[model samples]
Target: MSSGVEADIALDAAVVLSLGMNRVLGRTAGLAGRGAEALAALAAGRAEARAAALAEAESYDQALRQVLERNARIEALAETREKLDAEVALPEPLRPEEQPIEELTAWCAATDQALDGAERRLSERLAAQVAAEIFAVPGGAEGLRADLGAPAPEPTENETYANETYRTLERVLARLLPDATADDRTAVAEAARLLAGIGSPEEAEGVITEVRLRVGEANRRTEELRARERRRAAERDAAEQAEAERQYVLGSITSAFEEMGYEVQDGFETLTAGEEGAVVLSRGSWPDHSVRLRVDDAAQVRAAMVRTAPARSEDDRRLDVEREREWCEAFEAARERLGEAGVRSEVTWRLAPGVRELPVSDGARQTGTRSAQRERSREREK
Candidate 1:
């Protein structure tokens, strides 16, 4: 019995030991499965954190690149502004401060008004300069104004510089060319009109040159015409003076001859009196004698006596030589009578038709005196 009881106890102890060993093994296997699940969860979290860090780093790089690009664009805009300033020779525009959009807009509007005012002033100055240069030319202001078709309007308080200059030019032209012809006035008016339209001084100079040439030509023509008229007047005056001298000499001589007891016939060679009033003389007592007298402008006198041959017979024509001697004596007595009457005379005689002058002898003069006395006695008896 004791041996059997001991065997049962040993068997119970072995079974209990086996049961405790199985429970411990099951608990250990459960702990090992829980540890492995915890490790897998931790590893998943680490992987997620690493991915978030990488995403953050990429976003920062993108932001930095954008800022750099914006800075580059601003620098480019500033460079362009500087280039514009240099090219235009303009002062730099005021930069706006960090302000509200409304305030900035107001500032821009004010700046624009200021720039407009400056532009107006500059234009006025340029116009004044051009006008001054044009006026500096000789007779330029008057010449240009005359070229204008219409008279310049009176100046007004608000008139532009260009308009004021045009008015001044018109006045100058009026004073300078007061006697201009219609054509010249028209040309000047046209030129002035064109010059008024010109904007620059250079263009005005070209027009002035052309206008001056036209005016000079017109003046020269006028002078030539006046000279021609003066010459004609002088010629007429000289002719009138010469004709008056001739008439005075002829009248004096005709009256003088009438006082010498002779009938005066036509003047010598001409029907009318000439510069020297030469005349024919006839007396009833001297039927076959021919006498001529001449008076000069200086009142000097000369006389000539001639004899006529009888055409009825050749013998009478041959006797004309003796009659010519008697005529020569009568001419000497007539010369002495004229000298006593305040006229000095030169007497000449021709013996025949083609004969020249010859002097009378003292015997011929005595015969002529006897013939005159006989003619007086015969007249008294009748």
Candidate 2:
């Protein structure tokens, strides 16, 4: 009995120990699994935190750009509203029904156009100002220190076009004309004021001086050109007047020659181009001599014809006078081209009327025609 009791106590103690061991083993396994899961969750949380930080950093550039764009839009809207008000006047008396409906409609349209234009201008200006602040002021000061007109500071790649164009302009101008005159120096200083649309005293002086010089030269050239034109016009008038007189004389000479029954000689027209309209003349009855007209063709021919005076037919004297008339026309045409005083030549002729002489020739078409016409006239008269 004592042995059985001892064995039972030992067995009970072994079972209790096994149960406790099994519980401890199960608890240790569960704790290990839970620890692994906690480690995985910690790693994921650290990664998520890092990703969030990266996203925030990336967004800053976009945010800053947005703020600048918003500021520009606000300024543009404000300027547009003001501009529209300025351009379109309200109805007179500021009262209803005082203005025409058409005028009111036009005003509204003008106001809207003005607003649009102003908005565009303001947008452009705001963009410029913002860019200037960010780029021009700082970059320009650096340039000023680096001999102002030297090659520009190197630009950051893709870092906006900002002041690059202005910098490039200065660098190009510096190279294009390295050495400058007083005028060039003045141009440079004035260029800034002009670009900015600011009325500067120094710039204004340069402009005024340049304008004065140009205006003075313009006035002088204009006066000289005008004087030359006037002289040419006067000469033309005188020449035309002389030509008129010459034509008159030539007409008279032609009529007188035909009437006098004197056959016209060739080379007569050639002599008309000469000074004083003189030509050499000779005939079967007259000695060779020079003849010209004083008042051109008309006066000379009229003198020769002497309309009121009865014609005296003498072949010798008539031939001499006819030769002189041809020469005068030649002289006048020459004088017109050269525009100089013509040399005088002595040419003489005697005039005779048409009635005293009669001739019969196969060559004289006028003689036949005149005779026929005279017969016709006689018949009519009868």
Candidate 3:
């Protein structure tokens, strides 16, 4: 019984030891499984962290590329803006808040407005200059202000201010030089046309200068023509006055000769060689004797003379001498009569080639003898 109890105890002890060893082995296996699970979990976590880091790095690269592109575009726009500013000769167009497109649009709008305003001003200045030039022409300002009917209306959208001003100036110019030459009119018309279509202020100014020069040349020519016309008129007047004076002188001389009972020739002829202002006179009964009057440039009778034929015999010579004496006395009486009529003359007598000059008398010497002789000769002829 002791042995059996001991054996049972020993069996119980071995069983207990086995049970303890199994328990220990089971616990160790459980610890190893748990450690393997822990290690797998740690590796999975590390792989997830690595994937997250790669995704983050890729996102950062994309973001950096975008920033670089944006910076490049901005720099390009800035360079374009600087070039544009230099080209337009204006201030920097782009503001800090303006994008490239916005700044360009604003600049275009401002530039258009400025150009329009400048064109308008230049057009107005040109119009004024053209009007002034027109007014300077001869008879240009004749009632021009009063004749200008009314002001024109404003221009429409289709019409620019320059065109409107040009039209107005054209109207004024059309009426200005009514007597201008065809060439001058054509030149002015051409200049006006050029000025009307001018775009830039510089172009308009250059055209204005050219037009002014043309106008000046045209005016100079006009003035020259006017001077020529005046000279022609003066010449015509002088010629007329001279002709009138000549007619008056002729009439006076004719009247004086007709009052002396002599048949006077209408015009002067060269009776003697190298003699000027020699007038011949005749009577109805005296065929062999003649009378002459000498005149000066001033239409004044300088001298009067009686001429007789040459004697052929002694009796004829005596008669001729007597006739010459009678003629001298008659000439003296004629001189006295002319002096009373406000015409002073010197008496001369000519017999053959001999001439005798006598002083002018204020009173009659002996008119009865010559008068009786002339009366007898007239009665015999009748």
Candidate 4:
């Protein structure tokens, strides 16, 4: 139960919780977060513009209403005048100043002109107002709720609802209490969940906070109990990585042996570790020349096999085979040319499934012999 291990476990739990929350937030917000962020930088200037547009729109609407009211009044007055013409007796036209029809017609025309101008201004103002509203949607934290496509996180009831709340509360509690055992944390989570769904947020927060503290304490205690487990797990992982790296190194060495025609078997005979599952595989015939091979545990080997596929692509494999064949071909050509220098040599170029070797049987000319004209060709072919 070391402190380092406990700290690592707590940190791991925190990382896991953070990743999950990030994904949840990402899914809920879409790209509105970017827009929300952009709005804040320009809010001050934009707020003034928005206010001006809104004020202009209200002024226009008021103007429009006033024009309509005035027009209605004029029309009503005209109707009254018409009724008066029919109901009351009027003298025959005689005085030059008593030109009622002309005056009434002129008054109607002037009111109509004013009404038209007011209506046009109102229309323009409404368009500006619409633009302002679009530009002035609440942003930052306010925008977050809109961006979530959520209903502002209302509390709920019912078993299913409560369960969801419990899970959410559990996550928060887990973040708050990284060291607690899973079971103890779950208990705290359930209590917090119940509190979340109850009526009144003030009361809910008060109740949940207590449960959260209790959960945190339990989580911390559980962490202490599991300290040994965490330490052992870390050690196991370190050992595995070290072992994997060593196995790769050995494979590299075997590759060098195989190039010299030694028929290197790599893990074929368990040459290095000499643990269980080691084999006595022989390559050369009769009074055989053999190389011992050893390897990590089979579980480690299998995991490596499954994981190593991604290190190469089909195209890479194809190119590698082409390159190897060219090398072997040049080596074979070099051996043939070596005989011309009063040097007789026997060389074989070969490749096989799961193995490849090029053995030269020239005892005297073996020194740096693979280097003669080796820059040009190798005989190994697919």
Candidate lDDT scores, in order, read 0.42, 0.35, 0.43, 0.35
| Winner of 3 and 4 under lDDT | 3
For candidate 1, the 10 contiguous residues with the lowest summed lDDT are 1-10
RMSD of each: 66.5, 50.7, 62.9, 33.4
Across residues 252-344, which tens digit of lDDT does each residue of candidate 3 receive?
444555676667764333354434544556667555555555454323443333333433466754554455565455555655444332234
Q: Where is model 1 more than 4 Å wrong at Cα?
A: 1-199, 266-279, 286-382
CA lDDT of 347 in candidate 1?
29
| lDDT score at residue 279, model 3, on the 0-100 scale | 55
lDDT of 3 at 65: 31
Alpha carbon deviation, residue 292, candidate 2 (Å):
8.3
lDDT of 1 by residue, 1-382 (tens): 0000000001111122222222323332111222223323334556455345434333333333333333333343344334323221223343322233355445445645554444333323322333444455664554333234345566556545556555554343423222234465456545545564566756756665555555566546645654665577557644543333333333434555455556777564334435246666666755654455555433344455544222245554444445455545544465444333223433232234224433332334566678779999999999
lDDT of 1 at 165: 50
Q: For every model in order, what is the number of clashing pairs?
A: 11, 26, 0, 19
lDDT ranking from best candidate downward: 3, 1, 4, 2
**1 or 2, greater by TM-score:** 1
lDDT of 1: 0.42
Question: What lDDT, from 0 to 1, does candidate 4 have?
Answer: 0.35
Per-candidate TM-score against the hidden true structure: 0.35, 0.25, 0.39, 0.23
In terms of TM-score, which candidate is stronger, 1 or 4? 1
